[model samples]
Target: MKNLNVKNFRDIKGYVNHEGLVMKARMIYRGGPLNGLSEKEKKLIEKDLNIKYILDFRDEQEAQLMPDCSFDNIVYERIGALIGSFKHQGFDFGNLLQGKMTEDKLHFLLDYIKDGYKHMAFDNPAYHRLFVLLLKNDGGVYFHCSAGKDRTGVAAFLIMMALDMNEEDAIQEYLLSNEYLKESNDTLCEQLQIPFELRKNVNLYSMFKKSLLI
Candidate 1:
């Protein structure tokens, strides 16, 4: 699962559940978009990982703009877990890039993300379908959003909980994305010319801190 050319890609195997049982390796994976996967990478994912289902949490516009690389025998589904007007739920990175991230805007964005997490956790059809797919499919299920950190993170948390993983363990798993995506995030900060002091807040926009879970 490591060095697979996909951002934030990792096998959910080896994590201990509440029963103190480790999850089977290669049975589930999570990551970012699969748009630019190479042939070799696709073969690795198909033949090695055995991913049978790909559940995308991105909205229609996001998927259309950068569709996933299709694999034979894999079922693909797009379920926008946000469940609202895309524009309203979406974060405006352009504003951040333009140095418009004031304290008020930062607070607003944090509240928005926290609200989004709540929505995904409760009464969200996308997560409902996700559980259905998990039950129906014995093979691997690879689920992701644009960055695999918000909607995708919540989905991962739910799945771990269903497997009887503890609250703290599930939160730890969700926070791993910040580590996995560090390189990409740093590159993004460089591109946006974010000051060292502002980079932490900017990263918070897409990251899942333990505080957010609480």
Candidate 2:
């Protein structure tokens, strides 16, 4: 698991639930898109992680643009977790690239993200299927979206809560993506030439901690 090139990759093992029961290791992993994994990295994911299922939360357009690398014995399922919501509204990253992400637009984007989280938590059929998949399969299940910070993070929060982990613990786990993706996010902001003021207001690559209130 160490030295894997996949961004935000981590296991949910060893997390203690509210009852003080430890989560089993290697059974559940979360990370960013798997489209650009190296041969060595693929080997590690396939052999070391023994991942049998990949629950992709990316929309169809996102998947089409950058499809995941195929692996032996892995069943991949794509669920557009935000299909009807902000997926169509399209928060323009071009604004960020041009240093034009105003505070008003940033707040609007945060609202959209928060709404998306609520939809995923309450109304999305994808999560129901996810729980069913987890209940039936005992093998490693790897789930992710583009950055693995928003949709995938919410999924992780739901999963932890479903396992009887406390809400605070689940929220903390959701926020861990910010820490894990800091290097990549910093590099991205630098490359995109995002303004220091905008970066100060929000992380373009992260989920808001307040979004978990849902």
Candidate 3:
């Protein structure tokens, strides 16, 4: 079998990702502080997958944390996350979702759902622009963020809905955030010197599910 090699695939400096229906789309990466993947596997993707682009859902900090990606023919587009800083409390989504403020304090985040979450179909110009790209004859597109919950989940939900996926399917997709955040769990667990139980909040799937009216 022709093994996928990241080093070889990185020749073009494009982000390599899973190509065919060989597996489910996931949050796993080939390399990171946690369970890192091999460059060979990444090469397999570049050699076989038809990925057209990668829609990064991460904030600036998330990008800085991990920044070594290269692919052959794929494009990487960073769509600044919906999260803004919570300070000033004006319209800063970062601070609001930074473990304080309305998210847990006043809990008024839902008030902006139509603009920030549920109604994201067109509310976020960046997301919509990518959606349009996906709608075209693009090979495949993968969207992701830090935990793949909240902001990323909302984007997933809206995209699925637009794709005509049934509500059940859309809901299930959002729930995938739980598994996606495992990486964060490992890091937070050791960083906070706490058990995995306390780090359960790392699972972001439910956060998105809870925000929906359906």
Residue 15 alpha-carbon offset, candidate 3, angstroms: 26
Per-residue alpha-carbon lDDT of candidate 2 for residues 116-157, written as tens digits (9 for 90 to 100): 555567777777777877887678998888888777877888
Say which prediction, candidate 2 or candidate 3, comes out ahead on lDDT: 2
Q: Please write out the lDDT profile of model 3 over residues 97-159, one tens digit for every residue.
A: 445222243335544443355444445655775677666754666555544455556666665
lDDT of 1 by residue, 90-134 (tens): 644555446554667667666666565555577788888888888
**Local distance difference test scores for all models:** 0.76, 0.76, 0.48
| Cα lDDT over the full model 3 | 0.48
Instruction: TM-score each candidate.
Output: 0.88, 0.88, 0.60
Q: Positional deviation of 213 in candidate 1, in angstroms?
A: 3.8
Clashes of each: 0, 0, 21
In model 3, what lDDT does residue 170 have? 64
Off by over 4 Å in 3: 1-37, 83-122, 180-206
Residue 145 lDDT (model 3): 56
